[model samples]
Target: MPKALLTIESLVKNYGGGAVLNGIDLTVYEGEVLVILGPSGCGKSTLLRCINALEPIQAGTISLNGEPIRRDSKDLPRLRQKVGMVFQSYELFPHLSVLDNITLSPRKAQRRPRQEAEAEALALLDRVGLKDRAGDYPRQLSGGQKQRVAIVRALIMHPEVLLFDEVTAALDPEMVREVLDVILDLARQGRTMLIVTHEMQFARAVADRVVLLDEGRIVEEAPPEEFFDHPKTERAQRFLNTLTFETVKKKAKNQ
Candidate 1:
């Protein structure tokens, strides 16, 4: 059996006065790609934010390697280093070059030698086909390139678990595949990742397991083949059907 790297139990999160995530129980195993699929406003993004302690929970616990993640604890900074997140916005510093944006945290926050940090950053950038763009500012790159840099920035932290929240959602149709290909490469390398995305074909291809969330709860969970080919719940069937319709419509328009 695979070891559980991150465990969430009875996880509850609230927004304003209502519960956005109600009694969620999930486990992310080491070296597995777990993809979360859901409709809009189903709390997929919130779940990731809560795991990163970017959002506070109303109840329950999130544990990494058996230790609770407390937002106010002094150890929080160290804990965060082990859980990297890449967002759709590509969160790179506008004024900094790609290399600076990626190396800053390691050089300043972790106190690694500047040379060592930049070396690792360049290697990661090269893997993502952006080594030549290292000297380029965020504004100089395309949407896909910026997103790849964001992934490189996250990987340079050497995090054990990576959270990707709709990482391809903001990209153009042509740019989407390049970013997804980079993530696919990471999955093949056995990186433990929790992804929230609407790219159905990519999800089916990359996920070891697929989790379907609805109304802030997991409605179905199964291996990718089983989940996509034989979803066991009505909610899951309907969700897939809607996406299938959308995909067909988009394809027809393109043709």
Candidate 2:
């Protein structure tokens, strides 16, 4: 069996008396690409936020390598570094260049030398096909380029796990492939990742496992092939049926 890297048990998150996450239990194994599939307002993004310690949980626990993660803990800053997150919004500093944005945390938080951090940032930029855009500000790049820079920023931290929350959702249809391709490459490299996305084809291609959520609870969990082709639960079946592939294809062709 693969070793469990991040574990969430009986996780409950409440906002103004209503539960956003209703007792979620999930275990992300080492080198696994786990894709979260659910309709909007199903708390998919909230779960990722809770794991990264960006939100407080009302009940249960989240652990990394057997160590519990608490929101109010003094070690939260350090613990958060172990779980890198890239949001839908690029979240890059507008005034900073791509290289600066990627190197900021490494130099300030990890205290790495300037020369070493820049070298690593440049190498990562090159890997994402953005080396030539290093000196450009976030606003100067296309949506896909900004997202790639955000991914590089997260990667420079060398996190044990990566959390991607609809990183391609805000991009143009033509640009979506670029961002998704970068994520697919990461999966090919055996990086442990938790991705929440609506791109069904990309999910099937990149995920080792697929998790279906409804009303903040896991409806089904299975390998990508099985989940996409042979979902056992009725909830899973309904969810899959709702995705109109023909319509999407027609729309794509029109674009």
Candidate 3:
């Protein structure tokens, strides 16, 4: 069997007297790109947040490379470095330049030398076609540009696993491909990732495995082709039926 990079067992998270993640068990293997498919409010984003320790879990356990995640412990900072997350919003600091925003975590959290970090940062920016924008502020860049910077910042951390939470949802239809291209590049490098997205076409193209989550539980899991073409569960079938492939194709054609 492949080595597992992330493991969750009966995970549960509650918020304001309601359960957001209701008994989720998932395993992500090394160098695997696992795409999460689900309807809105089905705990997809919550699952990513919980895995990154941004949110607290009320039950169950999460282990990364065999180490249990402890929200109350000092180890969380280290854990977060190994599991970077990209959100729908770019979340770059408004006042900081793009270069500064990308280097802050490495400088503050990892305490790497400024020269080494900048060298790496520039290379990352270059790869994403934003080297010239290193000195530009977040507001100065477009949504696609900002999201690409967020992705580079996460990559500069060299996380063992990366999590993307519906990253294309906020972008204009035209800009979606630019962000998705960045993700596709990462997958090409064999980076281990767990992505929560509604972009089924992209998911189908890049995912090694696809998981269908509904009502806070996993209803099905399969390879991308199997999940999309022959879902094993009724919930998954309904979810796929609602995806509107024609609309997805139309958006692509428009771009």
Per-residue lDDT over 1-255 for candidate 1, one digit per residue giving the tens place of the 0 to 100 score = 999999999999999898899989999999999999999999999999999999989899999999899787788988999999999899999999999999998988789999999999999999999999999999999999999999999999899999999999999999999999999999999999999999999999999999998888999999999999899999999999887777778899999
- Which regions in candidate 1 have their CA more than 4 angstroms from the true location? 246-255
What clash pairs does model 3 have? none
TM-score, model 1 to reference: 0.95
Q: Can you give the lDDT of residue 176 in candidate 3?
A: 98
Number of backbone clashes in candidate 3: 0
TM-score for each predicted model, relative to the true structure: 0.95, 0.95, 0.95
lDDT values, one for every candidate: 0.94, 0.95, 0.93
- Candidate 1 vs candidate 2: the lDDT winner is 2
lDDT of 1 at 48: 97
